[model samples]
Target: MTRQRVSLRQELPLLVWLVIVWGALWQDFSPGNLLFGALIAVVVARLLYLPPVELGGRFNVLRAIPFALGFLAKVVAASFQVLFLAVVRGPRVISAVVAVPLRSRSDLLVTATGHVISLIPGSVVVEVDRSTSTLYIHGINVRDADDADKLRKEVRETEAGLIRIMGTKAELSALNQEVGA
Candidate 1:
């Protein structure tokens, strides 16, 4: 079997990110720490055989601003909602597993969406069906069909925003068709 060679350009971002992460973990930003982290990052990147993620999409930083803001807003709102349910209502809170169908076939989009949803307090991704591109999310306080539908809609809207920020034209067109349908 032949090994695929990864270019320096392709590994640069990963190397930089790893160094930053290492610095953060050690809580040290000194020149020595950074240099050591860079060495470690290079070694890890060279030794580790990981799958290559194809980020085949046009990234719009302008669109990312609103997405970031919206994600923050959702985090705050979901925190309050989860707190209210857990503290105020306690045992009466209902939970349900809801399946959210994805519009984008891109692995990056699906993985990003899952991470975003799981970050929110009231929902967590339990499973992902890559075959059908569906996410099974465990939602807190989902009392009825309306609540489930609302949760699904919120996830779809979040995905739509993500697609706007870093999705290919084909994914965008698929999103449009899904919305229109």
Candidate 2:
């Protein structure tokens, strides 16, 4: 098999990202640093044997706005809740692991859902079952069945939001079918 030639247009983003990272690492934005960074980025981009990652689906920035805001809200709210539970009412906290059945079967959607859920302070992704498209989330202050169900619902909602923002049309159709939306 013959090697594919790399195009400048294709490598442009990667080169720019590497240069930014290098400048940040040195804590200097001087022209000299930028030039050095560019040189390094060029070498790395050429020598690095990293495989191309296929990011499937279209990204809708407009749809993602609400999701981003919701994520921030969840993070802030969960932070306060965790703080209250840990500081104000220490030692009485109850935690449980919940299994959430995800609607989207795409790996990108599943991984993004897990990462977003885990970013909130009161919950974390303990395990992911790709075969079943299920996420085992460990949640703080889970008292009983009702609490577990609530957490599961929250994860489902987050997954739905993520699907709307970045999921394929097929995934969206599947989600709509599942939820009757």
Considering every candidate listed, which one attains the maximal TM-score?
1
Estimate TM-scores for all models.
Answer: 0.85, 0.77
Candidate 2 structure quality by residue, lDDT tens digits, 69-173: 878998898888887887987987789999999987778789999999998766899999999999999998888999999999888988888888878888878
Q: TM-score of the candidate numbered 1? A: 0.85
- Residue 61 displacement in candidate 1 (angstroms): 1.0
Q: Candidate 1: worst 10 consecutive residues by lDDT?
A: 49-58
- Candidate 1 segments whose C-alpha is farther than 4 A from its true place: 23-36, 176-181
| Residue 53 Cα positional deviation in candidate 2, in Å, after optimal superposition | 3.4
lDDT at 53, model 1: 67
Candidate 1 residues 1-181, lDDT tens each?
7879887776777888999999999999999999999999989987886766667447889999988987898889888888788799898888999999988778989999999998776789999999888999999888899999998998888789889888988887777887799
- Residue 173 deviation, candidate 2, in Å? 1.8
